[model samples]
Target: MSNIRGFRIQHDSLTEKQRIFIDDFSKRYTEKTKKSKNYISSNRYHLCDWMNSLGFKLSLKEMLYPIISHSSEGAYFTDIDGNRYIDIAMGYGVCFHGHKPKFVYDAIKERLERGFELGPQTVESGEAAYLIHHLTGVDRVTFCGTGSEAVMFALRIARGFTRKKKIVIFANSFHGTFDGVLGKMAEDITIPVSPGTTEGMVEDLVVLEYGSDAALDYIRKNADGLAAVMAEPVQTRNPSLRPVEFLKEIRKLADEKGFLLIFDETVTGFRVHYGGIQKLFDIKADIVIYGKALGGGMPIAAVCGRDDVMKIVDGGYYSFGDETYPDPYVIFFAGTYYKHPLSIVATLASLKEIKRNGNHLQEYTNNLTSILVEKLNNLFKQKSVPIVVHSFSSFFRFITVDPYPFVSDPIELEILFLLMILKGVYTWERRICYLSTQHTIQDVEDIVKIVDESIDEMRSGGFSFTF
Candidate 1:
């Protein structure tokens, strides 16, 4: 696997003239951290050393510092820096209460006092399920540790319930990091960018463009053995809002065609509304996947749906259920730490607060976001920049009409991302964002200001933007 050292350099915001400055800053940061921590010899890199040791990709390089440090936080930001920078990406919208939120942590503490786990049953898990059921009006939930696992169950349950294997998904929508749902981004309105995904999977998976009238027509014509039609009604493309009519038609088609409707609200669930984007869209699904900020920043996810649809894995039939322990019939869902009490406790507290406050981040932050989009768009227009501001709750994307990983573009997106990092803000390689409660109107204004400054600075470094 190609490591990130080169990736960082290419993605960094330094022109040849500015590279020396950034390199000097990096060296200073390293030296400062080492002296402060007073590390033994053979360990000069500090956080960088650990990251290099682990070999896992961290945020766009600049984020490496704060993540290790755990800076300003509460129900809002837990910045990596000693100072705060309004966390708009609440773990890409998962940490609803904010970084290491007191309520969540307090709940975890209470649960830890009670004992984190037992033979199997825990009060928090059942309570979490009950609360989830109440919130979504779903009949049952299968607990899992991440968005991908929940989605996998959803697919299997759909197949098992309908006795079908084909899944219909829309263009460029993401479910989880599983092999199944991760392929093909839209190109223009016609061509698509599909990486090494096998044609067979694509064949088994039905692909539809967002508003194509051909969707129902396609399903009507070829929904044979189709198990489910899954989507994030809030399209993950930039703004994350559902085309209102698009959602209604999808629901109509799924019903008429007798296939399951699945909503992968992994990103939008609680952030958009306590009821989720599905509720706002006036649509329903047989299953829904929740993650990102859904676990309030811990690793937990849910696959929930109507009861009749979720009975596929009843008792010990699947390998998971095949345990010979003389226990009552239990669906096999044992990760070494799925439903760890601490996470469940954190979830319970976070849900209570979210239900009470009701996704205030989206509401309070919208005006600021609108201002930002307007400002950024105007600046782009003024500069004739090719970038678009596909804004959503707190996060946004700057996708290229010319994109890659789906296409060949050695003029890597990483470089642009690094430029932003070199400017000092992290947006998770352009995938996720989390917001905190601490951001004031002033902070929002300042963010836009910083963006403008960053743009000008980047231009000085020879970057061009032509609307």
Candidate 2:
């Protein structure tokens, strides 16, 4: 067996027999996965080889090889090895309408036939903007090609509108891959998650604990220099950690302190409701960033805000011909594919479908997720495992307990991930699972069964709580 130290398996407290059992189980699991993925094993090996040759260093846990996808429709996708799995990751929550919904696909197809690349504007662009405005009650909307770009623009808008240098963000609240917002917690300070962040990248950032008094106190003292208080309405990885009162307090402070309240709803927007958690909680934001399910799998994102704030990007008003405009400052927000015709069509189709069935879709998915969480918790209780299942809207997580705190170790999480994938269920590395409108109650029940069996197998293999 491979050294447990390399995998970071912290089972030094386990008995000799238990350690042997775990090692033996790991070997068996390796053999089983290899046998099951024999057909695509070579493909994965070659792909990994190529990646290595190109100087890509991927950890074992990050590698999702031997399970290449072929095609997908609705709630399930077939692998290259002819294996079908219920897709819980759903392209990291982009396939809320499921893989290739007929309406969205047809819209894309129609746009392609007419002409995908025209110029800056398309018929669907105006229509999509209108739909978004009608749904979220935002005065103006602008499109972008990716969530990261949309967020970057939102921050820029906030900075321009408020004319403040500092911005505040909470721990573990991912806005995007943007360098300014990619910081992680280190002791009490926030440091860049990626290495390329310059020395002063976080100089203007006020990183705070979510829902903490320290955050509120800092905002109180430094509100004058803060441009925005940006947050994810529901943190994608840790969804159940919603700070309802904290959000309301932030909104109140933003109103009184002259800072913009920006909600990064990339994952929560269309998945939770037509207007996202803002609608659900009746808390309004000055600017909202949306992506993920916005285009039903197409690459599209929107930055929507009040007319006064959004007008900063009005190049027409800032034209040199307008002599009356004294301060003709223009906040440039542009991309060649800013309003891609295909993306617009897909967004329109997705919005229409969501509007028509949103109530039932949200209710059914939430209920199913609740049920799955209950079943998994019951299994954990039966096994006396120090783990609990929790859900927020349509998302679920498996949280560890005792010595490990609320988070699972990377190795443990990867083992659970592999087990779920082997049992025909797909989830992300964070142990986060999403339920789509396409998933039926039966599908959720099947997921519960697989989870139970996987846990049982792990327990039998000497997996035990350290405390």
* Model 2 stretches with alpha carbons more than 4 Å out: 1-66, 118-120, 184-190, 315-327, 406-410, 465-467
Please state the error at residue 225 of candidate 2 in Å. 0.8
Writing each residue's lDDT as its tens digit, candidate 2 over 1-467 gives: 42211333233455665556556655554554553345445456555443222211123322333445779999999875566899988887888888989999999888888877757478788888988888878889999988999988998999998888788998778777788887766675666666678647776776788878888998999898899999887787677787888899989999998999999999888778787888988999999998988998899999998888888876332455565563456687778888888888999999888788756777777787788788888877877766777778888778877765664353444556677787889765445678887888889789878877776766665665434
**Each model's lDDT:** 0.62, 0.77
| Per-model TM-score versus the true fold | 0.77, 0.87
Considering every candidate listed, which one attains the maximal lDDT? Answer: 2
Residue 410 displacement in candidate 1 (angstroms): 8.9
lDDT of 2: 0.77
Alpha-carbon shift of residue 102 in model 2 (angstroms): 1.1
What tens digits encode model 1's per-residue C-alpha lDDT throughout 160-219?
A: 778778887887676766666655534322222344545555545666776677776777
